[model samples]
Target chain A: MNVPLDPKTLVAEMSPVSTSEHIAAMKKALLKNIQRSAYVYRVDCGGCNGCEIEIFSSITPVFDAERFGIKVVASPRHADILLFTGAVTRAMRMPGLRAYEAAPDPKIVVSYGACGCTGGIFHDLYCVWGGTDNIVPVDVYIPGCPPTPAATIHGFAVALGLLEQKLKAETHVEAAGETAALPHPDIPYALRVRLEREARRMAGYRQGRDIAEEFMALLEGRAHTPGSFTLLECMMEAIAEERDPRRAEIIGHLAEVVQQAIRGEAPRGETP
Target chain B: MLKLLKEIFRTGEATVKYPFAPMPVCKDFRGKPEHKAEDCIACAACTVACPANAIGMETDTAAGSRTWSIDYGRCVFCGRCEESCPTSAIRLSDDFELAVGSKADLTRKAVFTLADCACCGKPFAPAKEVDYVARLLSQSARSAEEADRLRLTASTCPACKRAQDVHHIADMGIARQMTQELETTP
Candidate 1:
């Protein structure tokens, strides 16, 4: 039953003074966080620059990460976090490693973009040095071909929390180090339950599975029959169209080809 | 130690369920490669800009043109190709979970097609490129005197013609898609 809305009764039940004090303390902590500041330096061994452009925009007026006391420094010495972009190339390995080392003690490394995560599409190129994991001790891995600005910001926030937790335990605070292992969303039940003799495993559903198989089939032409569309002809169409370069909707343009190929209705060789 | 164990027990476990449940990437996290075909002008800007040489392109001269091939194995995810793209035909996205069993299975391709010229039976490019350089010629040539200049006798070879045809249709499509990459969308 709903109780009558009364400030006096609400205070009596809620412990208003204690609640107010707790809020004040939390506010004070948040303000303190903003004052201390955190420095992040971005390193681009060799990248397409799309990721770099986003990184540039993040520090701009609109996405100003400085509001959260996070600033991108140009030099590694002043940085608390090392932001690495692109796939680490043969030439870049030394510099990237040096950059990580220069970031001072209590430093963390955050590899941004899929290239940094696993060398991305360039996984086995001649010059590729693999992912950042091959080179140094990485505290956090931010996966994406090139992470969006919001994701970059949020990742840094998560890194900041990790830093705090790491430090708390360093001085003998004795907190659980693996708390991040099980995220909240993965757990569906509101209440905890004891496990039986055997735990049940649910079935799994996948999204990229079908599309990936279809794409691979088209690329290899493993499913193509005689007189069917050739991979070369498809490649020809892509090259010719790209020459005009609208450069605006490239992703959508690619999607169309992917869709057409998946349907097996892609235009055959040529119409004379 | 007892307090530490109690706090850990109280919070329960935080392991992400695999296959069935995956961790959500942060907002703006770059993941997979997504193409904006409408904005792409069928230009090979992204291909030319790629440092890892992951992007491969082919152009069919007569019917349709412009094709892009991405060899993920060769892609460095440096994103240089996306940035240097004069038409901004390519972009790196926020998808990271792109693992496959066969290494050869990860190559991706994209395409664009263009219409041909009705009068000359040649593909000059999309009508948008020159807004029908050939069509305007056709209309003005109604008079015998103007017919000489109006007639387009240009016979591009098979390879060149196919390339032109693809660009003709693709320009309109790419123009729509690469706007963000180009940064000049009206």
Candidate 2:
């Protein structure tokens, strides 16, 4: 039997926690002379539990984060690293702060997943504080919807100064006379549109676009060659060469679309 | 103890050599969205399609520039940007290692010049986008005159096009009324 804490007593206005100069100096010193294993404690504020699953997976036998002496502890009091996951909700903000305070001095705070990094898709939510850094100081940010096991390990390594951060801020400016090239200039735009639409209707968006591009490339290659072989023959040859039945069927359907365009006939399911 | 040791030897190692050796990801892994600014038209399609508002565009009309930005921290790696991109410019690449020490390092930006409208001389759209549309229309035009007209239409802003449409409709109405009057008199 446990007594629940009163919500009124827990709800109080407090400023963001700040580390003093001594704590900063101690953290730097700890990073430099750290010889022992770093224990991690996961403090989930208001995550969807996707980050938690990945975190657990990272410590499993397959990823084995324990190989680097990183252990997930049950209590923040025993933690050297605090892995914060979630977009800090108003309700959980106090508990999150308490966990941060519970952790000893010279603690490394690693913000895990996209939500923890910048509140992810829930950034604009009414009750969300946007990110973990909005409340507590974050040493590193591991950005992904739910970071893979490898990414989690990499983030830990970055937090412990075992590896350098790979991403850097970059800005690209448009050069003088810069222009985007038209895709498939040789193919008729109407025909290209029809082919793309039919492919997308048959397959999914991404796969359909890929298929349409491949078909156009083949058509362009054939047009460039000095052969008298008709486009139908070329398509038939392509269909015959394709090993995957599903891909072959899609290509066949696209070829039918091309044929319909060539014959000047309106596609099916529409009144001319 | 001997039997347990034998079982452990038979089971072998299950751990992966990650952070040292390259980890192989699946083919359809939704990783980082790589933006090719060179190929991008800055049409704001990705910005509009982004569910998390991770992709954004800021149009500076006074400066005649449009800045496109994506915050990897806010990005959910949903591939919506890749799907909505018309130019095939933004794509989801297989690079998922996006940990950073600073928040600023998680942002990527591209600045594109804006095109002045042919009629109003105002910065209306990205120069690359206008140029791409004009070329695409010209390529599809049946005749030289049609191609020229289509090119002009692409370069004109929407407000100017609407104004031209109103004038053209008024002229047609006057012509039709005069023709009806002449026919009735005869």
Candidate 3:
């Protein structure tokens, strides 16, 4: 059954709340001068609760965020830092704004998780506002699906001015005479394709690519070396030297593919 | 009190000194996706692989360029981009301290020039991709003429290639095609 939707409740794009110069100066002073304990209040604007779990874990004995005087309070009124988690769904927008208002002035607003930062996988959803910045001005953004406990502590340290942020905006423009180099220029393209296809069929994409790269490196290395042994003999020797059974098995299969290519036969396991 | 103190001393401190000390992360930790733009061909494979659309590419035919951008704020750190990158240009590094004061600081971009098509003279693909494919094809080509032909084929756009194929087929006279079709049918 489809429920009737209300057009009046829908929001397309809400501009981020503008902070006045006075308020901005006050916030800068608060960040610079404040040496007191920072009490964090978490506002769930409609999330999967993964960020909450990571937050809770950060406060646990192993992490013990209390060591730095960072405490998670029950009320937003007492919160020095407001940590907003989620994509800010339409239904939770009012509550999220209420929490933002409830926090005292000079409060540091933190957008937590990928969802809170940029709505994550749900950015295009009709109900989501995209990010916390869409509703209230955010002072910091902690991005991850659910940031690890260590990462959470690092984010807090960055917020409290204890640590500096590592990431910086970067842009690269194409330089003159710049070109991407081709991989394995010495190897025949057809043989490389056959080997890669065989390896990919055996393993998944990531591991398959890795295996193919290793096999190709070995192939190229053999070509450069002056040797009495044939290519097949070198491959057999390498296979015998391999310690891992699984990797050895994959190398053995790749060798078979190379042999088939040498014989001008079609790749195995495919309909003619 | 003495027994409690002794047990506490035996257990040692439970809290970890994180901020002051360098925290150790396990191997294969998926943290931030680092993009090596120099090695990236602007193929848009990572953009297509991104589940959250954190990595995106914009092609401008008028400008004759393709721009690749990645928003760290929206990234889920799933390593799908790393998996999809053919050149190993993008990989997840251990630097997880991604908190930024500004939203603009969370983004990275790379602009690459596009190669214009050989036939239509319109920007179609990244220049690096066309070059890389031509090089790869030439490596397997039997003769110098074949290699040059493959290079020409690689440089042409798909639309132009299709048009060439149609034109080639049309050059075979309609009467000849009809006779061949009739003979096959009989």
Candidate 4:
């Protein structure tokens, strides 16, 4: 005899597994009076394992997540908390669901890392489901590329309701007459651009901007102060005082650019 | 046992009291990207440079406003946003305890008004950005008249600027023709 099968059961459903109201109440109760150690079972939904490394380090002697009795277990059957990592790739979705199902009712789900929290840089990829919350109900999100061990501990505390979350949603509206202050208004715009470009070329962007700002401040201070030393002499003195050879060299290059501007000479390789 | 206990005492505690006491992060630690909206021009440089698309800007032409938002969950803490910011308004701070119970709490937003184009009277760029550019150009201008011209150019929309350039180029062509005719006659 031929058997008829339900097409709905045959096809893999894309909908997320929903927890019942009873389970939600139990989970809330569990969170409220969780006196025992919460055993965490890490489910790798298709992670790069950066989060795994950080998680392991959090349990190490330095961070010592075990101090709060947060233990990482190998089996989902023994888990009170299911820690999901990665963006939940298509192939691993079933396994992730399986791990979630294996854990007993009232289990807290923690979405770990940038990938697990929001699919990170790979959110738009074709094969990934984007985030753990897309596949399961996430109770807590520990967001970082891979959170530092201390951050991980903080996340665990938040998950266990032992600590209050520090981050709150904020929105700022622009007021009337709001204006961004021009950096180094004392320096000529052309000279400022040239100095910043030279400094950025020598050092990286963040450090370069910092160095340029410092150099401009020094220039402005020297100009204001009635000193016998000329601008060039002041720069040389500043460079001599700089302990770091690398920073000294960058400052020297910036000074040369300033000298070029003063003398009406074009920069070395480019036309005026 | 006594010797082991003494050795342990000598070594001191290695485990940090993190949640109980404030954890000290190292200097230059890349953690949270704090956006100072007061100093931000909403230039969209950080939005373009973001590899994760965590920082985004939504422009509402009808409302004449631009909304700048950053989702901390999607941010990789790479500091690219901090590096690409023109006004140094976005900087990475040491506030890394960013775990949250809800996803909505992970987002930060800023709303800025758009500036009307000087020529067209239509909203083109953010008001703060236009003001900043105008001020910068005027600061570098050689003469008062030149400063005024530069400020006008900075405030004009890109489309209007292009149209003005074309008209100016046509006027220059007519002038060049007149000069050529006069030189040939002489």
Write model 4 residue lDDT over A228-264, tens digit each, in one string.
9888889899999999999999999999999999999
| Alpha carbon lDDT at B146, candidate 2 | 99
Tens digit of lDDT per residue, candidate 2, span A1-272?
Answer: 23455678553444567899999999999988999999999999999999999999999999999989999999999999999999999889889999999999999999999999999999999888889998999999999999999999999888988899999999999999988889899999989988988887887788889999999999899989997999889999999999999899999999898889888899888766
RMSD of each: 26.7, 4.0, 3.9, 3.6
User: Which segments of candidate 1 are over 4 A away from where they belong?
Assistant: A1-35, A162-272, B1-186
Please report, as a residue range, the 10-residue window in candidate 1 chain A with the lowest summed lDDT. A191-200
Candidate 2 similarity to native, TM-score: 0.95
Steric clashes per prediction: 93, 0, 0, 0
**Interface RMSD measured for model 2:** 0.6
As a whole number from 0 to 100, the lDDT of residue B114 in candidate 4 is: 98
**C-alpha lDDT of all candidate models, in order:** 0.52, 0.93, 0.89, 0.93
Q: What are the per-residue Cα lDDT tens digits for candidate 3 across A172-242?
A: 99887777777788878778878887888888666788899999999999889886878789889989999
lDDT string, candidate 3, B117-145, tens digits:
99999989999888888887888888999
Better of 2 and 4 by lDDT: 4
**Ranking of all candidate structures by their lDDT, best first:** 4, 2, 3, 1
lDDT of 2 at A256: 91
Tens-place lDDT per residue, model 1, A18-97, is: 22455446534543565578888888866678778877776775556776678888899998777777878878877887
Model 3 off-target regions past 4 Å?
A1-13, A200-203, A236-243, B1-7, B174-186
DockQ of candidates 1 onward, in order? 0.03, 0.85, 0.72, 0.85
The order by descending TM-score is: 2, 4, 3, 1
Error of 2 at A196 (Å): 1.7
